[model samples]
Target: MLDTQGRNEPDTLNSDTPEQDLPALDIPKHERRVQTVIQDLPVETLCGRISRGALILQPEFQRNFVWNSTKASRLIESLLLNIPIPVVYVAEAAGGKQDVVDGQQRLTSISAFVAGTFPGPSGQKRDFKLSGLQVLNELNGKRFSDLDSATQNLILEATLRVIVIKAESHPDVKFEVFERLNLGAEKLNDQELRNCVYRGRYNTLLAQISQYKPFLDIQGLSAPHNRMADRQLILRFFALQRLTHLHYRGNMKQVMNRELEDHRDPSDAALKHLEELFTRSIDMAWAVFGPRAFRRYQPGTATQPDGMWEERLNFALWDTLLYTFSFYQKSDIIPNADRIYEEFLDVMTYDATFAEYVTSTGDKADRVRYRADTWRRRMDAVVGPPRSDSRTFSRKLKKALFEADSSCAICSQQIQTLDDAEVDHIVHYWRGGQTIPENARLTHRYCNRARGGRED
Candidate 1:
């Protein structure tokens, strides 16, 4: 039986072995306090464990195997030519269990290469053929091969060394451990981390919404921009059941994961409310058009004389925004959902697409292009500026320095303004500091000249 308090205590469940007794378990109750040990493990055994699902990728765990074709092929070369791989890190779990805490990418890459699958940034590339230590590839259908044999043998002998830790049994414990261990490494964002933790009903819902054609097709949404949006969408659609303005930060993932972990199954009441809202939103999107297809909204100022495409697409955009708002609500439908929905509809109908002109394909096409371009430009406009308001440069600079924790690159002292500081070039203007963000750094007025006005 599971503990009502959800504690992994001895009284919670029955165990056939005394070794399985909760008290006998020497691991720490909280994962954050746990220490890791490095161990050498065989690649074959690791793959076997992963395939059997005995190895659980804690919900907050990240799957970042950044190896491209060349790197992947080298892994195969080492293996085939009989080289040693490095040590692998495995986190010790309860009941004498262990999991790959690090080296997931290396292990995964080795598996992929052996299985004859190599993935790139876009998709799988079948063109990779391992020749000694080098990877031969036909780019644009032209052939290029990897480095030579002694290198191949050297690669193969690479040892697999891993830093292993004991994973805490509970989700909360695991989350805390994940947070601490992932620092300075490529850490998963809150949502992604949340997704890692609660790989249950809520996670499925999130994945569904992420890939949902209507939602995913919306513009200005991509992996980086959508991280927060994705979590917000799931929360609003299922948890809140209504549209909510997104604050975009906070421990949203942790809060939501706790809620889901508590609820073993989807609540009927919540699901019914969500389904109704979903149907209503979708129906309303097309209701303005007619019994047939929906029309695009176009303002009077639009270049097109008359068309419906603009309104249709705007409806789609609004729908996308509304979906995000709904998900942002996080598990309970909000009272303001209807108001938000209506307000967005109004924006789509009037501000975005006025009825003065009919929005056809060409008109809708142009509006979509304009909106995409405009939104990007608007976002970029203030991105470099520190303050949200752009008219005041000094205010913007101050905000950037303070909010971003920016400091003089050379002195490593924080800078607040032009009065005491100035921008210095890493490469002299004669050598090309070029006045770009990368080459420029905040410096004291005297330091700027002393260091040749360079960041370095």
Candidate 2:
């Protein structure tokens, strides 16, 4: 999801996914719920709802309140002057709670001003004083508290016509309406919509995993902000894994929806297992490639030996590497970290199959398949076929292999001592070689590492 310049900065909450995965414009009328109601709420009553939790301002639905003192003062000026403000829109959530769909900045500005705390100097909240009034210069330097009783009553009783879309509305319908109505800078992307629509244990897991240090370090993003872009990426990883067996809908949103529905309320045991895999894969990814993880590269020349590293995060590459790494624990991948990294670079550089078409048609299942399968086969070659076998053979097997053969099976060299000797798999552990004594041999640890495993 990086640009050509390789500057995939996560400073904003907006996702860089090229596709818009929201529902279609023409949904069936029978499935739609677009009822709405209007309430003329006074400023004081509305602010009290915010205080008592009857109203909610979800960050995922909009951007942070960024109005300055001058702008806020203008709003207060309008209230004092009785100028009709713009209509506010809200969605009726469960428990009769209203979520602000639009007008967050205006609402927050009113709330902040009435509370005597406006966004002031040095990013700190301080008592708001009326300033920068073009026509109301006479009212300058007056806080809300400084107002006379009649003026205070006017400010508190200022009417705001709020249109609340009822809770019966479908999520996609709500999302569709909000897309048009929302005038905020941070529009709800797919994941943000999912975060709003699917509030459950699995969604909570996505938020949790996105903050993981290795995951954040690799992504170069600090946390899940207003848009929940990182949360989307986290969802992609787990969702795609589930889709490995399920039918593939080419549409990404449908794919994500299925995944969320499948595990909306996962058991503690299930969450624990998935979490282990996520953390382990992330740890292995960071350990193996470091900053180069999920980045692209150009093939190297004979002189260069290793090609140039392109600092970009390709989502397709991210899917392949992270998903493949998830199958094994960190202990499985850590031993051959250097080898894995170098060989992976070579694959990206020399092999066109793995490197090509990562952007244009990358989301296709076949494209994901060959790339992941290639890397996985390479892993099997390097770290051995995943037979749940431990690297450490028992002491009895080590001694028996040593006693059975005084010479190393790999190099046919004489064993010096057991301290320097290591149990090497004869058939190569990577090639489905088991840990049985028949397949065991003694060799110098140096020889084993440098050049040991063989095929018969």
Candidate 3:
């Protein structure tokens, strides 16, 4: 437990902390600044520090774990060889205590190895056979005791280089230090804290819905975290209903709490509402673009940079929703708004074929298409005046053709006629035809040219 300075404040450093009393230590020439391997630090002690209210994983921060156990073991072997290891960072706890910032995995492994907790390969034990001159004893063969004294001495000597950072007064200040130190580094994300807020509330609701007979097969939920971020966005997209500028700082729990408190009681209505929405929207995605195209669009491949899968998926779903809303605006038999939202999620998540299709179109083009379509809609609403320029009319005409379902609006022919299709005004320009949807259609280039339809 953190020893509190006052009843209300937990472990806040006041004026008398050691950081204030001790003069700053200079870096030694031999031990300038390097990570050091420290042995004999008990596993119990380490785990205790981690559990004691330390912000183990900062929100939006993920610990680096690319280095596998082999590298870790090699680090251990280097320590055993009495060679200088790298410098390890240890932050000062509130009352002159310390916590590891970097090298946590190596530290944890050593602790686990000390406690005989590491699963050795091929039924081997957590012991090593060493060959060298005896100092503390030879550290050899399966278990701590098997190591002779010299090896133990080498491990102990390595611990001497550990540089401890004595935290200054105002212990909460450490959080600022932590943030600054990691500002450029990869950080944890908001969705990671779903349980912290909604332990028995919204998250529970989502979990229950997921386990229910119909929802158990949500493959998106089972994907890797990047893909799952896409899943999370799907959930948040519907839950929030506006994606003009979604951010990582928005807490899902707070939103869920607000939504739940508005309800009458603990019921399956909300859960089922979300599931049904995903199912319907996914159906629409399949219907509109074809499932094969959707899969190619799933943005979670290894080739892309880290942490982009979810954002791209979010963008795609938002655009698709815009498309659906626009398409169904004139129809009375439109599916339930809530149901369509959920189906959109399913199309993004479980429908691998749909994911591929979207990926195949490529991310850059999809984004461009979304932006262009949005601009086209805006222009359509604006050009309702008595008159406009030919340039304005021409741009709007091109956009309509681009957004239309078929290349040739009249005969449902493929629009890829390579400069052979011309935008025809439903109302002739000379006949005072306005630049609008009703006045737009696709015609063969030759037909349009022969008709002398160039001027507005």
Candidate 4:
């Protein structure tokens, strides 16, 4: 009902109020409706778009696909059996690219089945045979190619509804609308949203590396994190490596988001190198610290490492400890476990710098830098000073050293190439040796780590 000024009255909810017609909601005319275009595109056309990269079948972030071949095959059978399936929701981005926001499983499975390769138990894509069809029992065990010509046409020509949320519907708005529509569904996190914002191989690497076994074993998990927590941790590792040298400043979340945006599409080699770095560093961390890898240590019990670590994981300590580990190779760190673990425990158990910064204001730039610095300094005191881009010998000095004797000082073997040669401190850095050329000797990267700070 309109009031005296023509303003609509709020609807009354009094239990005693008599039933009456209520005015419809008066939404502002300028408010934009979700501009969407619907198409009943044939399965073949949809698959073609996916293959051509015009339509993205996978969401930008890696989804833990719950559909096994059995589930995927059922989707195919439904298509062939003429059973109606749900519509695929695509968000049309600028440049005419369409990203799948919903129905990823159905579309991805159909495309994979048609292509003859589907994700197997090990994550490798392999050719699959159809199975578990209730009605088409005779069609079970048949590959896509095994189907007769008429059946193949039936599969390809089947129409699937495609709902395109026009590019004008911003990504943020799309997410909010989707969540509002899917009320009671799980909420999305930053990393999950990044998977949509940043579409490329780097995002895939985040998903893949988050499942590294040693890290999971340390965390006491049998599977990858269903939430993107592990992925964020992995991302922080890479982002810090990039930002640390620049003396990073900003909110951690913004830093991570910018990093993802900057390197959305990294080269395969770059991804592989990062994989090795994480694998090697995490393996050494697991070897040295065991289950107590990243938790606060203080208890006196046998259930945890050093009889003192709590069950909770510490994010600050995780990056700080792993940064120290990254300075040395896993091969050398394994043998030095006794010293490294003892030092790490001393820091975790007693050092104020390590304890204070990590427990509170942990994400502060100063705290982050000092926590890592404190661990690195302690580690260097035991293992010796490491090669530094800023503190190391000049290129001229390095050349003179190699020319004087092109042999590894530690291994006492001929150095094959300049790329494989690294200058070592004759008197360990912690033992008061200067980074001067007189104290430096060229050695292979492998030999230097294996030497483990011992005097020649």
What is the Cα-based TM-score of model 1? 0.41
**Worst 10-residue stretch by lDDT in candidate 1?**
11-20
- Using lDDT as the yardstick, the better of models 1 and 2 is 2
Candidate 4 accuracy as lDDT:
0.70
**lDDT tens per residue, model 4, 71-119:** 9989989988899998777777646898787777788888888888886
Give the higher-TM-score candidate: 3 or 4: 4
Q: Give the alpha carbon lDDT tens digit for every residue of 114-201 in model 2.
A: 8888765445788888899988888789888888989888889999999988877755566557656643544556666665545568
Off by over 4 Å in 3: 1-44, 47-69, 78-104, 119-142, 149-222, 225-228, 235-456
* Candidate 1 per-residue C-alpha lDDT over 1-456 given as tens digits, one digit per residue, 9 for 90 to 100: 112222233211111112321122223455335555666555555555666766543323345457666666566655655666655556565446555555566776765544445555545466445533443332222212343455433433444666765443456566556555556566544445444445455455455445543333332233322333444344533432221223222232333455656652466685556544554443333332222222234334357655333311232233233333222221111223344334434554654332222222111323433443333333233222112221112434544544465677668876656566665545554232244455555666676667662212
Error of 4 at 30 (Å): 13
| Local distance difference test values of all predictions, in order | 0.43, 0.72, 0.40, 0.70
Query: Model 4, poorest ten-residue lDDT window?
Result: 9-18
lDDT of 3 by residue, 113-164 (tens): 4454443544344443332324423332335445567654555445523445
Better of 3 and 4 by lDDT: 4
Rank candidates, TM-score, best first. Answer: 2, 4, 1, 3
Shift of residue 142 alpha carbon in model 4, Å? 7.2
Name the best candidate (by TM-score): 2
Best by lDDT: 2
TM-score of each: 0.41, 0.71, 0.35, 0.57
Q: What ordering of candidates by lDDT runs from best to worst?
A: 2, 4, 1, 3
